[model samples]
Target: MNKAITEGLLLMPPAFSNGLDQWSSQDGTVGSDTYDGAVNAAFVAADQDFGGCLELLKSETTQKLRAMVQTPLHPGCYLQIKARVKAISGNLPNVEIAGWAGGAGDVHVLDVVEAGPSVALTSYGEVVEVSAIVGTGARNGVDMPWGQDALYGHFGLNLTGANGGVVRIDDIQITDVTNVFLRDMMDWVDVRDYGAIGDGVTDNAAAFNAADAAANGRQVLVPEGVYALASNVTFESPVRFQGQVTAPKEVRLSLTKNFDFGSYVDAFGGDEVLALEKAIQALFNFTDHESLDLQGRRIELTRPIDVQDVVNNISTYAIRRVIRNGQFNVLADPAWDTDVVTSTASYSASTSTELTNVANIANIQPGSLVEGNGVGREVYVKSVNVGAQTLTLSQPLFGAASNQSYTFSRFKYALDFSGFSGLDKFVLDDIEFQCNGISSGILLAPEGLIFHVRDCFITKPKDRGITSHGRGCQGMLVDRCQFISNEQPMRAQDRTTIAMNVNANDTKMRDNRVMLFAAFGVWAGTGHLFSGNHWFHGDGETDGVRRAGVIFTTPNPKSTVVGNYIDNNFIEMTNEHDATPDWNNQYSFGGITITGNIFTVNDVAPWFSWIVVKPYGSGHYLHGFNLSGNVFRALNGNIERIERVDETYAGLDMSKSRNVVVQGNAFNSVDTPIFNPLMVRHTEAANATTWEIPTDGKLPFGGRARRVEGFVMDQQVLRGSNTAHYEFPYVSLQQGADQSEAHLKWSQACRGRVQITLRMDNAT
Candidate 1:
């Protein structure tokens, strides 16, 4: 047996000494090899109590130290990362030994060595295998760029929020030594320095050009400072360009121009023609070097001649030709406010007028009244100058706060990244993006790619915030994240996770918090898992009511939604103007296993309450769902009538979906017990091909279509495995008329350790 020892640390196996030569004592700041490995000078008492018995007091200068190990790693190698951590202070933070793969940019965070309440100073440290970062088995595999100056990278010891504590490590080795070669390796490139050109002073266009030029499948590190952008920046590669480090008080990143239309759509005649031609060329068939006739193809115009006509013609793409009206002479003639009459009371005609000497107070005016072709209604305008408008104005006129705190004007997306590809693993960590007042702040489409987002906060999403669609991407994990939206928190397009056109499998959404949105929070696609999330959708007078704390949609076959807490939602919608009418739409699934969750819906929005398990798109193949061991408290919705089921389509909608199992679930303070908990599918009304539910009809008997088959209905089904103390005495048949095959059996008196045996056999 070999024993290796350092100054204040001891370990078995001499291999630790070689691996730890790169680390020096904590006398001074650790060199670049160790980022900041200085033992806290303030930790005088703590360090002295290492092997001593002085009853060490927790020091005030608690700074966790991090170091990098100098080891050579190659392909096909298996490494066991072991760390012996002892927390001698109050609630010591978990000590982690992380492996940083150079090529693939992978950081495998190993098991946590924590000093729990049970973890004492004696027998405090133990060696455990966190995980294996195995290299590829291919012969021409990659070798970790070790020993080389540039190719080599450093692993960081993130003392995240670990104030004034000490942790020790030993037996850290890369074992199972099969070498993964360089050929089969995934190369990782991180933009270490995002060269900022303009300091919001000189010129920012160079910074954008340099960033766009250097934005590859790496990180574009933007130093914490003001980068004044004169023009729109286009990032055609997978890169992250960070702004200020300490989060700018006003706007960390400010584009010189208020709005850049050329950034999103090419208004230039040449580039637009080229893009159009490329698209048209793909559709046409050329044969024998002879060009086909591409004439007589006409494009329709859509923008209405005026503002009132805006909603009328949508399919049309005609741009509104604005002729500026005369400027208001506020100093000479204050004739606009009291007697607001002009060439045309319509804002449409006002756009055509030019205002030379008049100050464009369009920015500061509270609201404007414009005339429509028919009768003029009070249409509020949020923007003064068409280009630049305060982000606070994005809020609805009725919901505007009394004391407005101005931040920044609503700017276009900082970077238009639709053209960039191979960026599935794009990382935007440790940064802040303020819409300052923008819309849909950071729109991302990892679009059929694998990505990792950690330690990031995307706030002030004006509209449907942070919309992402992973059509066929897998292993997308969003960890330690936050999103604050005024509207819907997150919206995912159809078939985002499952194998629609691509396979979106094994997606993990964990450790996230969302606050106060208009609609659903964290809405994901089919065949995904949601765990360990704290969501709060506040129901106040200002915010419009939304759907669920976390809603999963579009018919997922097999998925698990567990360990989530949703409080104060759905039932809080009021009957007032634009209020979220229903609140308790919680934990509804067609073919899912919902376990270990809590939902609380009290007063405020009552008309819509209760967890609904309704089907989508005519309720087809909604089978094999399990609801077990969850708690629902303070739920109050209409006991008699569940809200509109087939409101989108005319059909005999299914009240209960097929093959659902509800077992070992408890409900408290619940007025309207679950009626048709499993909403089934039925035939649509004639002449209805889409989800257009008819309003006039009696809405069919028992709410919607249902199936009373080999399963438990109204009451909770008991599956004999769980250990929770639950009793279902009177199982009532909610909507079934005759003695159907599926019937509820009520036990006369269920006692203390009584469990129900519900076996769902598919016997026709």
Candidate 2:
């Protein structure tokens, strides 16, 4: 909006053709004009086609030709002067229309830009328009510096510098243009009033600040135009934007009173991307408010926004930042796509951090998720040295190997927090991330504390949802959240992405729903509580074959997976990465309690078990584990044992794994009828050397007997004739094929019946 001030009533007479009422001669006399200050300069009612004219005759350089305008003056007024002049006859005079400035009263003697081209009359019979901007700033201008007693400007035709000539000046006009600069009498301050040009060329930052400074508890109004704010401008007061502003993101603009996205929408000409970017930046900086409430605006993002890098990589920040109550729609822009690269690296058993001689090392970005054979879950690149062909990982990979090829997938998140290491207390609450089957959800801070994601919906994340690649998840909490993958419609075995990945310890995941990715979650850390979650991962698998619901990618014996409803999913307790069962005093797969869970499946696979312990290396055993009060039911056919070692490898080292618990579980349509320890009796004939006893495969792990008590009795005669004679048989145990049946050998031939008692106890 062109807020240029409107002119008031004419300062001159209503008509210059009627008579020179306010006009005067050079000697300051009204109705008296002199030729060369001595002879005829007169007002003509009609001269040729002109409506009115001030006819003047100029002959000498000392001759002041016409009268100056007499008008009322004000302190903060802009006096605009204009006239149409022409050099009519005789020697062409260097004549022009000019103005004079005065103080306190209308008394004369101040020439303001008299020689300026704006008021020059050069051609004969050709109307040359002349004008001047006069205000309290100068004799002619816009900015009004008040506090003066009074100021006035006088306009007239000048011939003092001209040779002998005749000049005709007509249509002299003047008006008070003070409304453009007047703000003290109004309720708001306009940016135009502070000399702001909205042509998109001039920097209005200073003018914007000036208007805000003069607001005086009133709203500062930015009228409609494209204004460039070349510098950082902060509006500390209430501001209304009918216009838009442009500035680089490097500038910090704090709209303290209106910090929400709605205000930015108005400020950025309704560009949602620009609006959201600034709003989030303001949120992280804690401008005005610590939390940026988007007010449920659906923002469309065409690119990834680096949360911490936009703030210049502070590396250490403790302010609580929150972004809530909105949804971000990811556009199908190639710049927002994930980066995937296959690289070869050399590893060592000494340290898993140095992945050297890496191919495509320069293409691997920092914070990229590392995956492949022997790579640990949730491992990411902390830094990369392309020249040295090495990548410093956030943590060690799972297994030890050399010259291995790995895939580095760097997923672009809607909000990336990978730049800072100590940005603690971050929150994303009550929001939705719509990845559109292309982008990911969120990348967490590298090393922060108390990162909480609650009451949010992560929809269609292409790679993973809510990743913790560093120690930022030390005490992370994900509560009442839902992760819906884009590949959720695919079968469990065909799904590729995971809903989440955890690395740091002491994290709690409660009451969250996962839409069944290939792996629901990749867990590494210990001391976690995962409860009240229903993670179903079964689809079109008639054979009842699927991946593990939760993969213990590392040794975690302190975590509890309890009270969950798992569908067609099993728990995988493995040391596939680091095969040391008791490395660094951390017991492998032991001390974990899986209780009070309901496991249900529809298809049939006789070998499909509910719990599988996979120990890749020798001597790796399950030192301690618990499985109690669980209900396992198969719909189609019978399954194998409820808990067993992976059939592909040798069973667990039973001598080292003595504290295994498998009891109090109700099963339906499963192969094993019961799992309680069983006892049996075997009768021996006369002179028999061996007595075979059948054990009902009721051992805790289907392998070895924990304890056995037995005694031999006389079977043939019912009573021995020599009762005092030694007739007891020496005990020799022979384990059966499946290790369920027990065989006993006798040192001497004796007819007897042997009663055996076997038991395995791990209730503690």
- Give the lDDT of residue 531 in candidate 1: 84
Locate the minimum summed-lDDT window of 10 residues in model 1. 321-330
Best-matching candidate per lDDT: 2
Candidates' TM-scores? Answer: 0.34, 0.73
Q: After superposition, how far is residue 124 of candidate 1 from its true place, in Å?
A: 93
Query: How does candidate 2 fare on TM-score?
Result: 0.73
Model 1, position 454: C-alpha lDDT score:
53
TM-score of 1: 0.34
C-alpha lDDT score of every prediction, in listed order: 0.33, 0.68
Per-residue accuracy of model 1 over 1-764 as CA lDDT, tens digit each: 23333222222223333433343232112243321233332222333323211111233332222234333332222223333444444545444343333323333322322111112232233332222233322112112212111111223222334344444443333333322322124332222122232244534444444544544443343433445544434344433333321111121122222112121112112232222222222112111111212122221111101111212212221221111111101121122122232221111112322111222343433222222222111122222443442211111121212222222122123222222222344443443334322333333333435545555555554333343322313456666677665443333111011101112456666777766554333333356676876566655433233354444433343567788776654311111111111222322235567778776654434444434433322323224555667777753442232222322312212333345555566657544333223332222222211212111212222232223332222333333332322433332332234212123333322112112222221211
How well is each residue in 486-556 modelled by candidate 2, as lDDT tens digits? 88668777777778877778788889888777767877767888888888777776785677888776644
List clash counts for every candidate, in order: 70, 8
What residue runs in model 2 are displaced by over 4 Å at the alpha carbon?
Answer: 1-188, 376-378, 398-400, 579-586, 647-651, 658-663, 673-695, 707-764
